[model samples]
Every structure is written in structure tokens, then in C-alpha cells.
Target: MKIENIRPGDIEAESFRIIGELLGDRKLDPRYEHIIKRCIHTSADFDYADSLYFSEGAEERIARGIREGAVIVTDTKMAQAGINKTRIGKYGGQVLCYIGDSDVAEEAKSRGLTRSYVSMEKASRLGRPVIFAIGNAPTALMAICDLAEAGQLDPVAVIGVPVGFVNVEASKERLIRSGIPCIVARGRKGGSNIAACIVNAIQYSL
Candidate 1:
């Protein structure tokens, strides 16, 4: 098979064009089109078109929060690294991943908890608007839900898409019912890349 010669700058645009063609006649909510397309682009999986779920007004809330300089916290460094820090910075926003922080590690170890869980606890104390983009750990989603239930946290929005077999769907379900603005990938299909792409798609749409 011969590779098609294409200009570097046109590759992404071309890819989206193809995705649109393949999805012909499938109407997408205008608010979520870019996010769904970005998810498919990142993973080359069309399943995202059907699996992604958005709570009412989630996009608007997230956009407003970002404009207000909400801190974006991710479960994994890979997710954090994939986010467009420069673009978010233009709005005075920043991306952070605390899973690898030394203090988080120590606390998790002492408490016999996953570092991802500890990270959410740490984030809850920020005292400012926050957006959680959790893609690799269901426990992180659980921790956030727990915090919310206890009246200790009120995040601007949550992107819950952790991929796994154990407790993944349940955690996402909990987040969905928590009454927080969120974007979730139903079932057991998601990743750090998907999480970051979703965040980037939101930023791009703004």
C-alpha cells in the first residue's frame, strides 16, 4: 500500500474530513461535535461517537470555568502532558497531574490508597474552580464523588472516562448521578489520551 503524500499542516484537517464523511447522516450535537471528533481522532475508534455522554450544560459550564481560570487536574501525567497548556494559559488556566507528586505518594502509601485517589483529595483543597479530567483511574472518579458527597468539593466540571474492567462503569455512573457537570464515556472504553483530547476539543471550541 502506498502512503498518500500530504502536507503536514493539512493532515489533521484531512483526517477530520474523512471522519465526517464516514459519519454521514449521523447528526451530532453541535456543542459536542469537536469533542467527539477529537476522541475519534486520538484513538481511531468510531465508538466514541456513541459512547460519549455529556450532562446538560456541561460544555457551557466548562467553558465559563476555563475563562475564569479554573485549574484542570488529571489522573495521569500523560493526560496532563497531552493538554494544550499554552492555549489554556492564554485564559489564565493551567493543567496539573498530582499522581506522581511525592507528597501524594507518601499519603497514599500510608493510607493504603491509590495515588490517584489521594490526588483528588489534594485537588479538593485548592479553593478555586477546578475541572477534573480523569482517564486512567476509576478510583480517582470515586474519590471525587466521595468528596462531593461529603460537601468538601464542588468542581466546575468533570471529564470521567477511565478505562478498565473493575469499577469503571460504576464510578462513571456515580459521577453522572452526582449532579455535577460532566462528560463521561459510558461502558469501559477510554484512556488518558481520550481524556486530554476531550479537554483540548473543549478549548478549541471556545
Candidate 2:
């Protein structure tokens, strides 16, 4: 049966199975696996989309793309995080820089991205036509979308990928309330491994 067709508990089991197939013994530890199992099983509702996480610097690459010309809205952490991949010239898409802190913003500036923003206000001024909000900073992203709707910012598509167990629903619900298309993986499947896997799929699909 399809993943969506199953109950929440069943879906968690299926997630374990799929993750097991893809990741194998790396995540097979009983305790961590049990945590994942419990989280997915108890959370009654969720939306499944390709998700991604970054322990190293995948968020940096994503941020760089935004800075250059990509119309994407991300959390402070993802925006500030730097990209550190061996394959540099592979992602030649778009760049629209939106960041949270001074350090990441400074780094983006060094990369010739002077149009970086530290707040949702900056994101508004940038006027990106499409905004993809990734990771768990929902309230901030919602504020950005609200501004867009209020004519204070350029209107665009708002998507949220809130990784982690914290405020996952509230963040996603904000996106939903804004009448934007938000894609999120179910439950606590918002860690580095799942996040990386989700991004990998997006890369391949794109």
C-alpha cells in the first residue's frame, strides 16, 4: 500500500522500513530508531515531500543559490550556513540571498552577494517571486509571507520544510494559513540524515 494510505503508526513503521533500505545499519541503532518510531507513530497528521538536512554545509549551498538569484526563503540557520561541497559548478540555478545572522551574511557578501538580508524585512525588499522556506523556523517564515500578502513585500510562493520535532506543526500551519504550498516530511524525520536524503532527491529531480 502507499505510504499515505496507512495510519500514522503504520506510516512510521513504513518509514523505518524505507529508511532501513536506503540507509541501512548506520541508523539501525535500537534507541534512535525507537525514537523515530515513536515520533512518527504518535503524530497523527503530516505531509510528505522530499526533505533535506545538513550536518556539514548543504544549507550553505542552498543559501548561496538564494544569494545569487534563487527566490528562496529559509530559516536563519540555513541562510547563514555556508556551502562546502567538492562539486562547485554543478548547481548553476538561481540565487536569492536571505539570512539571519551577521556572520553568514558577511560570508555571502564575500562571495559577491551584497544583496543579503538579515531580517524578514530584507527578504521583503529583495522581492523574490518564489520563496521556499526550509527547516524549522516557521514563525519567521510566516511573517515573511504575511508581509508579502500585505503588499509590504513581493508576492511569491511560500513553502516550508520544518525539520525536527520542535514546533513542526505550528511552523507548517503558518505556511498553510498563508495559502502557500508547504511540503514537509512526517513526524521527527527532520534530522541530518533525513534532511540530506530529502535534498538529494530534490537535486536529482531538478
Pick by TM-score: which candidate is best? 1
**Candidate 1 lDDT by residue in tens digits, 7-116:** 99999999999999999999888879999999999999999999999999998888888877899999999999999988789999999889989999999999999999
List candidate 1 segments past 4 Å from native: none
Q: 126 in model 1: Cα distance from truth in Å?
A: 0.8
Q: For candidate 1, what is the total of clashing residue pairs?
A: 0
- Per-candidate Cα RMSD to the true structure, in Å, reads 0.9, 12.8
Worst 10 residues of 2 by lDDT: 45-54
TM per candidate: 0.98, 0.46
Q: Give the TM-score of candidate 1.
A: 0.98
Candidate number of the best lDDT: 1
What digit string (tens of lDDT, one per residue) describes model 2 on residues 1-206? 55356676776458657654654444332422332332233332222312211223333444444334455444544432322222322443332335545765675577653222234556666644544545555445556566757878643343345555566666555655555443344344443233333333333323
